[model samples]
Every structure is written in structure tokens, then in C-alpha cells.
Target: MAAKRGGAPANKIISDNRKARFNFAIEDTLEVGIELKGTEVKALRSGKANIGESYAAEHKGEIWIYNVYIPEYLQGNRNNHEPRRPRKLLLHKREIGKLALAVQKDGKTIVPLKLYFNDKGFAKLEIALAKGKKLHDKRETEKQRDWNREKSRLMKNLG
Candidate 1:
């Protein structure tokens, strides 16, 4: 999703976890705000972060993102944030409860898809409820992707 600001769409992407789509089947998604420290936000603004190996979980009734690597800000000397800290995710109580219960009952895992700044300049995260893809399913996805690429090339040649 995107928001408009000053008559322009404001969705400046910071980091994207492309690996998530290849490894899991995303069933549901939500756009959530992220809570970040000063240094963490500075580091992210510089685009020096990775969320490819990150996942979210509930702890003590709150949701947190784990394993996301936002490197220390170069200008924030002596007061930099941890690079691999488990950051808190800002979500509503009802949504948090539902996501927690979904994980418990349906075994779906919460994965971060993309990180971006919204129109109001607030950091946001796109999270998805996904199930792991089996080996065969992964292989099939690869095969289908390859076929589509080849088909597009052939069509272009014919045209």
C-alpha cells in the first residue's frame, strides 16, 4: 500500500526481503509501523540494512522482529544501536492477538517483506503470514519462472 503527500506518492523503499517469496507461500499481509531507535532509523535511512533472515514473533503479548540487521550509523559514534537487535513492531491490539493466535493454531510464521517510509515520513514494515514451501514446491516455482522468461523471449522474437 502507498500514501500520497503533496500530491505525490510517498513510498520510499528501504529494504526488501526477496528471499521470503521464494521460500514461503504468503497467505496474508499487513502494513505495520515499526518502532526504531534514533541510530537504527539513521542506519536504515542510509539503506544499510537487511531483513532477509528476519522473522516476527510474539513475546509477553507484544510483537517483535528478530534477526534484522540494521548496521550502526557511522555518524552516531559512541551511541550507536545494536546491529541485530529484536525491534518492536507497532500494531494494534486486535491485530496482534489475531496474528499470535494464527501462529499458534495454523502454524503460519510472520515474515517481513519490505521496509519503507510512508507519506508522513514514518517507517513502516510490510509483514506477511506465510507457510514454508516444500522442496518440490520450490522447484516447481523455479521451473515455472524459467518457462515464463523463455516464453517472453520467444514472443518478443516472433513480434
Candidate 2:
């Protein structure tokens, strides 16, 4: 583990990527470390992070997160990292191998599920191996969700 810092542990969520869950079928999740600048880290500490529009892409065999917006730190001037610059995700070799296999075998993609802080105050990303859901699949999921809601309503009324 990296050197622990701050008073609070990190696994606490800073922002969620709800669209990923709705748009894809998540098969597996992996936690990876984010390489962030000092200002970005500060923004994350203050929970000013957004992962909803973020996605991960493999470039030259390394995974980089894209569209993750970390707002400029209030006090930092001229040195703040670009809010949506691609950030590398650090994962173990074996884990990367598994993810690569899954991507190749299933035509799945690794998507960022959320961004959070870990127990040691390090920024962490939850990435999911996911298959994109088709339009009909999305409709079916919504229908099922609605049916479940209605079923619970009827059950509550009867009971």
C-alpha cells in the first residue's frame, strides 16, 4: 500500500458514473489507481469530481481514463491540470492481462464506473468490464424495472 495520508480513508465515493450501469452490462469490476496532479487531488478531496462522462481506453497497451473532469482547485493558479485530460490508470500486470482477455474474447470494453478515494487517501477508479447494451436491451431493462416497481406497489396495497 502507498503511504497513508489525511484523516479519512479513501474508498469513499466522490462521483458516480450512473450512465455506465444503464448503458452497458457490467461483467466484472476492478479497482485501479489514478494518476492525478496535486490540484486535481485537492479537488477530489473536496469531492469536486465527475466520472459520469468518463470512459477508459487502452493506448499502446496502457489504460487511460478520458473525459474525467476534475475541477480546477480554487487556490491553484496556472499549474492546474486540464480538467478533462486523459489520466492513466495503474493496474497490476495479471489484472491487465485478464481485462485484455475479456475485451478480446467478449468484445467488451472497460468503462469507468466511478471515482473515489481509497483508505489511504489515494484517488481510486472502479472500472468495469462491460458489453454495450442495444436499444432493445435498454428498453427491456427499463420495462423490467417498471414492472418490478408496479409489482411492489400492488403487493404493498394487498398486504
Candidate 3:
């Protein structure tokens, strides 16, 4: 059954990293821009990108997104870029420096949250600074989530 709340249908999300939510505790999140070629941009507009296997790394003090696959455009003539190319993320110098420091000192990693288009029709990425969870932590989180789901279901039925 489709779940709706507040007299509105749920948001239609294109894709999500279900594993990320199950495996990590996200500490902070930031929205960043991706530098892409024309062909890549067109492919993204068609909702043809996946960041599930992607990670962000600091190189020479700049943040670059790696392993995010954007499939080739079928109608491209000859300018298609590689599928797994590393793309530079646009951020302020201070933000880059802070990310580098947090990564190096705290051992936290940046994981891609989701890739989606904003209301302005531009492709944007939501990235998160996450601390990896241990095995027991994941189990506990799963238990809590299941309990919450049951509680909500009971409340709806009773009310």
C-alpha cells in the first residue's frame, strides 16, 4: 500500500542508497555541485546516475567525488565521457579545508547521500560526513526501526 501523510502523496524520489542508511551514522550533510561535461549533464538530467559506490576524497586540498557512475548517453555522437570518471565538487576553500581536517583527524568519511534535481532543474548532490557503524550498532538500529514501524502501524489502526 502506498503511504500518505497530511493529505499529500509521498515525495517521489528517483534513487537512494539504502545501504548507506543501514550501515552508517550520518554526522553532517552538505549539498555540493558537480563539474560535468555536456554529455554527462544530459545523462544526469535523464536520471541516469548512481552514487551508491561513490566516495569523496581530498586530493591536493580539493574535494573530488570518485566512483560515481553516470552511464553513457545512447544518442551521443562522439563526446561521451568515461562512466567512472572522478568529478571535482565545487565548494569554498574553507569548506574544503574543514573537510580535509575532519577526515584526517577524526577518521570520518564522506558518503554520497543522494543525487537529484532541484526545483531549478540543475543536478545536485547531497553528501554526508558519516562515521561507520559497528556490527552491533547496525543490529540495534534495525531493531529500533522495526519497533517504530510497528508503533506507527498500531497508532494508525487505533486512531
Candidate 4:
């Protein structure tokens, strides 16, 4: 596991999509649970899952996460799971309705920000209702990040 310097809670995290913040203007976030298979859980425990290219979509009045890669567990000789299978995301009925409405009418996206296990060891997803950022907006965000870094350095030296 990587050092928990300034990111998520070190123990529970499986994988984090750090670039989601840079690519989207997140308007709201929700903690949703994930349904995984036996081998998938083992893969996650080994910290070999990738949610970077994964996204949540509504299907048959339910939400599912697509394109997430949970690599097959090596020890599973023949019963290993698929690497890029669509997984179900557990959410409240109202929340799913709201997200579907937003995507249908408001042009918003359901992006997965991070993947981790919660306090009770259940796999959870940090999803966000977001709008895609424009090129100029991305440039502005980059500038702000650089300025923040410089300001922090100056403050550290002075104090």
C-alpha cells in the first residue's frame, strides 16, 4: 500500500481515481456500495483494481458500474472472474431516480471518484454527479493548483 500522506483513509482504500476531480466539475458526491464476486473481492484486497475508466450507468431502473477492471485473482485456477465486467452499484431508490433524471435532463455524468472498503469491510464506491470541464476550465484549475502549491511553500518558509 502507498503512503497515506494526504489522500484517503489508508486502510480502507482499494483504488482511487485521482484524475476524476481534474476532469469533472463535481457538484455532488455519494457513498454507494458495490456488489462484487468472491474472486473480485480477493483482487480488490490485493489492490489490483482499476476504476479510472469506469463510470456508472442506469440500466433497467438500476445503476451499474461499467468498464471497471478488477483483475482476476491469480489463485483462482478456473473460477476467476472477468477483468472488465459490469458491476452493480447499490443505492437508494430515490438516489437512483435523481441520478437518472440528472443524466437525462441536466446533462450531468455519474463518475466514480474512488473505490474502497468501508469500516465494516464492505466495498464502497465514491461517486459524484458532475459536469465535464472545458479546456479553458481545465487550464484555470491547473493554474490554481500551481498557485496553491507556491503559496503553501512560501507559508512553510515564513512560519
Candidate 5:
């Protein structure tokens, strides 16, 4: 009889905030753990989480993410977690200090870019230190994206 060969688990993305890139100029990103209830974890595993409107900020010396929506686990019944509760993010003291300083001194914002299960099956949130884009900057970004899409089409047609 052959022994079972269980390989390392793969990182699985549960949700992404695609508009974050278009709305802000990202300076840095960090992957931090999230403290979630059992029902929340079950809901996320079903790929029903949304981080599109979520943002992280320092609160009482710790970082907490707000507005992230993890729907109630249908099977959880009476023990379901809140759908839009503020969740605490886990990070090193040094990293938290850096994020806090950047937000305080540089007027930057921390936004959740993605939420996923890491290779070890633990849930992680990728947060970005970003500066908000001005109206003109946003228009320029849109123009550049349009040009890139046109260029890609031309290249594909030629090739």
C-alpha cells in the first residue's frame, strides 16, 4: 500500500478590490493576518467575501479593518457572525508603527487590496499604504488605461 502524498496548500484569493489601484497611488503593501470568527471563516471559504469598500486604520494602537463584508455562513444558522463587523488586523509592532507614522505624518491611507487564504491555509489581508489620486490624476489614469487597451488590441491584430 502506498502512503498518501499531501502537498502544500495553495494561496486562494477570496476577494479583491480592483478599484483601489485606479483610485489611489499605492506606495507600499503588506500582508497581515485577520482575526475572524468561525462563521466568518466558513463564509470566506465559500468565496462570498467582499473587500471592495474596506479600509484599515490604526485604532487604539492596533490596526483594524472596517467595512469588509463577509456574509453569514448559511449553515451557521443561529451562530452566524456579523456581515460587516470591524476586524482586527495582526502585524508586527514595527510594521504597525510604520503604518501609523505614514498615515499621521504623510496623510496616507491604508486600504485593503485583497483578502485570501495563504499557502498555510491562514487568512491574510493585503493592505496598501496609498495616497488618494486627484481628479486630474484619475482622468490621466483612465486615459493611460484606454491607450494601453488600444495598443494591446493593435498588437494582437498585427500578430
Candidate 6:
């Protein structure tokens, strides 16, 4: 077998929704392409996008992301894109059907997890089908995280 010349290309992450995991119980995740304008793409290249409060939804038989803030490119002049426009997501018909069904029947939300540029330099959004966490569930998650951190600290000291 021939040896590969290089490893896989690393994705350049533009934004991450860290609180999404704490607030939602993620069931499934999908990588979907994003439709971007020229200025929007340039803005993202500067790594100033925010997906923390953004979410995806089925609109007119297609998936669209809302509330995502991609700041204007400083050098874009008069051609800058809107900062919080609803952007279309690119997915197959089958995938769109599945997501629509999950939202309508399963009471699940499509939450944006991360926004990044793939190895091929295409913009992508990682979205999750998730159910909102209850107050008790959130508390339990926090407690478990704290316990794991303490356990790791103790083990490090002991070893």
C-alpha cells in the first residue's frame, strides 16, 4: 500500500455554541453547508461570527438558520451583508425530510452547534436535533461535570 502524503486537513472553526450542550440534550448531529454572500464569507474568514444564539428550522420546505451574526467585513464598503440574516442551509431532500419530521413530530429543536470552514474551504454548520433540558437535568449535568473534574484532580495528585 502506498503511504498517504499528508493527514486530513483541519477545519477552521469560526464560532461555537458552548451553552448548547448545557441547555439541550443532543440526539443527532448533521453537517450542512451554508449559503454565504461574498462579504459574509470574508467576514467569517476574520473569525467574528456568533452561533451561540442561532438555530435552524424548516422554512418553506427548506432549512434556514436564524439569529446567526456574521459581522460586516470592514473592507466590504457598500456590499456588506446583513449581520443577522436568515441563511439557507444546504442538505439533501431525505435529510431535510428527516429534520422536518423530527421537529414537527418529536418536539425537537435544531440547534446550531458550530460554524466552521471545512477542509475543502466550504462554510458549514453543525446542527443538532435536541430536546430542551429540564432544570433538574441541567443541575445533574453540572454536578456530574464537577465530580469528574474533582476525580481527575484527585487521581493526578495520587499518581
At residue 152, candidate 4 shows an lDDT of 100
Q: Identify the runs in model 2 with alpha carbons over 4 angstroms from their true place.
A: 1-10
Quantify all predictions' global Cα lDDT against the true fold: 0.92, 0.87, 0.83, 0.91, 0.93, 0.94
- After superposition, the stretches of candidate 6 with alpha carbons farther than 4 Å from their true spots are 1-9
Q: After superposition, how far is residue 106 of candidate 5 from its true place, in Å?
A: 0.8
- Residue 24 CA error for candidate 5 (Å)? 0.6
TM-score of each: 0.88, 0.88, 0.86, 0.88, 0.89, 0.91
Residue lDDT tens for model 4, 34-92: 88899999889888888999999999999999999998898997978999989999999
List model 6 lDDT by residue over 56-112, tens digit each. Answer: 999999999999999999998886788999999999999999999999999999999
Q: Provide the global lDDT of candidate 5 against the true structure.
A: 0.93
Residues 22-110 of candidate 1 have per-residue lDDT tens digits of 99999999999888999888788887788999999999999999999999898898878889989999999999999999999999999
Worst 10 residues of 5 by lDDT: 3-12
Better of 2 and 4 by TM-score: 4
RMSD of each: 3.2, 3.8, 5.9, 5.2, 3.2, 2.4
Give residue 132's lDDT in candidate 2 (0 to 100). Answer: 97
- The best-first sequence of candidates by lDDT reads 6, 5, 1, 4, 2, 3
Candidate 2 lDDT over residue span 63-148, tens digit each: 88888889988889997778889999898877878887778887998899888887777788889999999999999999999999
Candidate 5 error regions (>4 Å): 1-9, 152-159
